[model samples]
Target chain A: MELFLLSNGKLSGEAELLGYAKRQLLAMIERRNITSAVFVPYAMIRGDYDQRAGELSQTLGIKVTSIHHAESPAEAIAQAECILVSGGNTWMLNQMLHENGLIVPIQRAVREREVPYVGWSAGCNVATPSIRTTNDMPVRNSVVLPALGLFPVQINPHYIDAHISGHMGETRDERLAEFCAVNPSESVVALREGSLLHVCGNDLRYFSAREQGFKVFRHGAETREYQDTSALRSLVPFTCH
Target chain B: MELFLLSNGKLSGEAELLGYAKRQLLAMIERRNITSAVFVPYAMIRGDYDQRAGELSQTLGIKVTSIHHAESPAEAIAQAECILVSGGNTWMLNQMLHENGLIVPIQRAVREREVPYVGWSAGCNVATPSIRTTNDMPVRNSVVLPALGLFPVQINPHYIDAHISGHMGETRDERLAEFCAVNPSESVVALREGSLLHVCGNDLRYFSAREQGFKVFRHGAETREYQDTSALRSLVPFTCH
Candidate 1:
C-alpha cells in the first residue's frame, strides 16, 4: 500500500499545483509505470474538475481523468491504476464520497490492490477515520462526521500556528486542542501548508517544502514539533526518516 | 423576543468578558427586570461552567447560574428568565442542546415568555436555524447541523477579513462564499469581533465595540458590507436601526 497525503495542493509563491513535492510525486508515478489515473474532485467547491485533472496530467506527465465522467464512480475507483484526490471543501467532499458509493471501492483498491493514492487538504482529510479535524465549514444541511478510515490517525491538513490579529475565534492550535480534549485517546498530526506524509507498505515518511517539521497534538500534553517522522513511528505504522 | 447575539465574548484590550457590550446588556437586564439568568456553558470545552456563570454574574450585576446544576436541563430552560450561552465549540453546544431536550423548551421561553437571550460565538451560531455557518471544528462523533432556529437567518460570528500570511486554507470570506454557493437560497451574516446584533421584538439593531460594520453574503449577489442592520430588513424579520 502506498499513499501521498499532502496538506494542500499549492503553496504560496509556487506556480504549479503540488509544485513543492513535484519530484517526489513524479518519482512515485514513474516507478509504478502508471500511465493514467482517476481524479476525485468532489472536494473542489470552487475549481473546475476537468481543469484540475488537466493540470495534474501536465505536472505528472500521465493521463488524469476526473471520476465524474465515469458512468459509475465506484467502478471507476475499482478499475483505476492510481487515484488522485483534490483539495477543497471537506464536508461536501465527504458527503459526495458517501453519496456516490465510492468509499468501499477506494478503500478496497488502496488496501487490497495496493493502488497508489494521492490526496491533499480535504482529500487528505477523508483518508482519516473521521472528518473531526478538518478546518472546513459544514456548508450542507445534512452532515456525516465519519469518513473513509484509510489512515488510522486523524490528520489536520493545512495546519498553522499563526492567528489573525483582532479575531477572537479559537486559533488552529486551540481547535485541535479541543479535538484532543474531546477525543483523548486519539492523536492528531498537524501538517503545515507545504508538508506531506508519504506512506509505503508499512513505512511512513514526512516532507516539508519549507524545511520545517510537523506538530503532533495529544490530550493533557504540550504539543511537540518534529523535523522528521520518527515520533509517528510509535503512534502509527511508520518508520522515522 | 429580546436577543443579544454577540460575535465573541471578549475582544483585545477588553478587561472583562462581554465588557464591550456591558452597558447594552445592563440596559436589557434592567428593562426586562431579569433578576437571574440560566447560563448554558456546553460549548465551553476547557473552561469551568461555574466560572463562566460567575463572570457573567459580575459583568451583568445579576444572579447567573450554570444550567448544569439543574437535574433536567430542559426544566431549567423552562423556568429561566434569561439565557446566556458562551463561546467555545459550536458542534458540541448544538449537539448537547438537542440531546438534552433543551431546544424546544428554550425556544418556548424565547418565543412565548420573551426571555432575553444572550449568546456569543458558538452561542450565536446555535441561535440560527442551522449550525452550517459555524467556524468551529466538528470534534464530536454525532453531529446535528440543525440548530434552535431562534434566528431566522444564519450568522457567522467572529468573522474577520484579516488573513495570516502564507496560509492556504480558505479565508473567512471564502468559506462563507462556499456556503452561499452550496446553499444558494440561504444567506450568511458575517459578524466581526466585538460586533453584535441586538433583537428587540420586531426591531433589530447592530452594535460594534470596535466601531466596525458586518458583511452580508448571498449567492449570485454582490457581497456587501453595512454599518447598520438596515440592509438585513428585507432578508429577515428585523427592523434595521
Candidate 2:
C-alpha cells in the first residue's frame, strides 16, 4: 500500500496546491510511471470539482479526472491508477464515499492493487480508522463516523498549537486531549501544517516542509513531538525507512 | 418555553462560571422562583462533574446537582426545576443524551413543563434542531446528529472571526458558510464569546456581555451582524421583546 497523507493542501504563501510535497509526489509518479489519476472532490462543499481537478493536473503533471464525472464512482475507483482526495468538509466527504459505495473499492485499490493514494486535510482525515479526530464541522445531518482505514492509526490534519486571541473555545491541543481521554487505548498523530506521513508497503517516512516535527497524543501520557517515525512503528507495521 | 442558550460558560479573567450572564440568569431564577437545577455534565470529558456543579451552586446561589448521581436520568429530568448544560464536547453530550434516554424527557421538560433550560457551549449547540453548527471536534465512534430542539434554528457557539496567523484550516465564517451552502434552507446564528440568546415564553432577546453583535449566515445572502433579534422572527415563532 502506498499513501501520501498530507496535513493540508496548501501553505499560506504557496499558490500551487500540494506544492510542499512536490518532490515526493513527483518521485511517486515516476516510480509508478503514473499518467492519470482519479480525483475525489466530495469534501469540497463550495468549490468547483472539475476546477480543482484541473489544479491537481497542472500541479502533478497528470491526467486528473474527477470521480463525479463517471457514471459509477465505485467502478472509477476500481480502475483508478492513482487516487487523489482533496481537503474541505470531512463529514460530507465521508458521507459521499459511503453513499456512492466507493469506500470498499478505494480501500481495495489502495491495499490490494497498490494504487498510490494522495490526500490532504479532509482527505488525510478519511485515510485513518475513523473521522473522530477531524477538525472539520459536522455540517451534514446524516453523520458517518467510520472512514477508509487505509492508515491504521487516527490522524489529525492541519494541527496547530497557536490560539486566536480571546477565543474562548477549546484549543486544538485541548480538543485532541479530549479525544485521547475518551478513547484511552487509541492514539492520534497530529500533523502540523506543511507536514505529512508517507507509507509505502513496509516502509514509512515523515516529512515537514517547514522543518517542524509532529506530535503524538495519548491518554495518561505527555504529548511530545518527534522528528522521525520511530514512535509510529508500534501503531502500524511499517518500519522507518 | 424558557431557555438561556449561552455562547460560553465563562469568560477570560472571570473567576465565576456563567458570570457573564449572571444578571439575566438571576432574573430568570426570580421569574421562575427556581431554587435548584439539574446539571448535565455529560459534555465535560475530563473535568469533575461534582466540582463544576459546586461552582455553579456558588455562582448562581442555587443548588446545582449533577444528574450523574440520579438513579434515572430521565426521571431526574422529568422532576427537574431547571436544566443546566455545561460546555464541553458536543458529540459526546448529544450521544449521552440519546444513550440515557434524556432527549425526549429534556424536550418535554423545557417545552411542556416550561423548565428553564440553561446551556453554554456544547449545551447551547444541542439546544438547536441539530448539532451541525457546533464548533467542537467529533471525538466519538457513534455519531449522533439529532439534538434537543428547544431552539428552532442552528447555532454556532464560541463563534469568532479572528484566525490564528498561519493556520490553513477553514475559519469559523467559512465553516458556517459551508453549512449554509449544504443546508440552503437553514440559517446559522453565530454567537461570539460572552453572547447568548434568551427565550422567555413568547419573547426572544439577544445579549452580548462584550457588547458585540451576532452574525447570521445563509446561503446566497450576505452574512450580516445584528444587535437585536428583529431578524430572527422569521425563523422562530417568537417576537422581539
Candidate 3:
C-alpha cells in the first residue's frame, strides 16, 4: 500500500495547495505514471468542491475529478488510479463516506490494488482507525461511524502547542491527553503543520517542511518528540526508512 | 425552570471554582433557600471529583455532593435540591449521562420540579439541543445521543475569536459557522470566558463577569454581538430582563 497522509493542505505563506510536499508528490507521480485521481471533498461545507479539485490538479499535475460529479461514487473509487481526500470537517467527511458507501471501495483500492492515497487534515484523520482524535467540531447529527482505517494508529493532524491568550478552553495538548486518558492502551501520533507520514509497501518515512519533530502521546507516559519514524515501528508494521 | 449555564468554571488568576458567578449563585441559593446540591463530575477525566465538589461547596456556601457516591444516581437526582455540572470532557460526560439513565430524570427535575441546574463548560454544552456546538474532541466510541436539551438553542462555551500563530486548523468562528451551515435553521450563542446565561421561569439574563458581549451565529447572516438578551427571545421562549 502507498499513502501520503499530510498534516494539512496548506502552510502559512504558501499559496498552492500541498506545495510543501511538491517534490515528494512529483516523485511518486513519476514513479507510478499516474495521470488521473478521484477527489473526495465531502469534508467541505462552505468551500467549492470543483474549485478545490482544480487547485489540487494544478498542484499535483493530475486530472482530479470530484466524486460528487459521478453518478456512482463507489464505482469512481473502484476505477480511479489515485484517491485524494481534502481537509475541512472530519465529521461531515466521515459521514459522507459512510452515507455514499465508498468506504469499502476506497479501502479495497488502497489495500488490494495498491492505489496511491493522498489526504490532508480531515482527510488524514479518516485514514486512521476512527475519527476519535480529530480537532473539528461534530456539526452533523448523524451517528459517528468508524473511518476507512487505512492506517492502523490514531493520528492528530494540525497539532500545535500554542494557546490563545485568556482563552479558557482545553489546549490541543490537553485534548490529546484526555484522548490518551480515555483510551489508555491506544497511542496518538501528533503531526504538526507542514509535516506528514508517508508509507510505501513495508517502508515508512516522516517529513517536515519546517524541520520540526512530531510528538507521541500515551497514557501514563511522558509525551516525547522524535525527529524520525523510529518510535512508530512498535505501533505499526512499517519498517522505518 | 431555573438554570445557570456558565461558559467556564474558573477564570484566569482566580483560584476559586465558579468564582466569577459567586454573587449570582449566592443570590439564587438564598432566594431558593437551597442548602445542598448534587454534583455531576463525569466530565472530569484527570481532576479529583471530591476535591472539585469541595471547592464548589466553599464557593457557594452550600453542601455539594458528587452523584457518583449515590447508590442510585437517578434516585439521587430525583431527591436532590439542585444539580451542578463541572467542566471537562463533553463527549464522556454526555455518554455517561446516557449510560447512567440520568437524562430523563434530570429533564423532569428541571422542567417539572424546577430544580436549579448549574453547569459550566461541558455541562453548558449538553444543556443545548445537542452537543454539536461543543469545542471538545470526541474521544469515545459511544454513539452520538441527543443531549439534555434543557436550553432550546445551542450554546458554545469558551468561545474565542483569537487564533494561535501558524495553526492551520479552523478557528472558533469558522467551526461555529460550519455548524450554522450544516444546521441552517439553528443558531449558536457564542459565550466568551467568564460569561453566562441565566434563566428563571420566563425571564432570561446575560452576564459576563469581564463585561464582554456575546455573539450570535446563523447561516448566511452577519454574526452580531449583543450586550443584552434582547436578540435571544426569538430563538427561545423567554422575556429578556
- Encode model 2's per-residue lDDT on B30-95: one tens digit a residue: 888999999999999999999999999998889999999999999999999999999999999999
TM-score of candidate 3 on Cα atoms, chains taken together:
0.99
Report the first chain's TM-score for all candidates: 0.98, 0.99, 0.99
Worst 10 residues of 2 chain A by lDDT: A232-241
Stretches off by above 4 angstroms in model 1 are none
lDDT of 1 by residue, A1-241 (tens): 8999999999998889999989999898888999999999998887899999999999999999999999999999999999999999999999999999988999999999999999999999999999999999999888887888888889999999987777779999999999999999999999999999999888899999898889999999889999988888878866657
Please give the DockQ score of every candidate, comma-separated. 0.91, 0.88, 0.85
lDDT tens digits by residue: candidate 3, A27-57: 9999999999999999999999999999999
Tell me each candidate's RMSD, in Å, in order: 0.9, 0.9, 0.7
lDDT accuracy of residue A237 in candidate 3: 90
DockQ-superior candidate, 1 or 2: 1
Model 2 / residue B203 / CA error / Å: 0.3
- Model 3 in CAPRI terms: which quality? high
Model 1 residue A147 CA deviation in Å: 1.5
- Candidate 2: which pairs clash? none
Shift in Å, residue B225, candidate 3: 0.4
**What TM-score does structure 1 among the candidates reach?**
0.99
- Candidate 1 lDDT over B1-241, as tens digits, reads 9889999999887879999999999998888788999999999999899988999999999999899999988889999989999999999999999999989999999999999999999999999999999999999999999888888999999888888899999998999999999999989999999999999999999998889889999999999899998889888777789
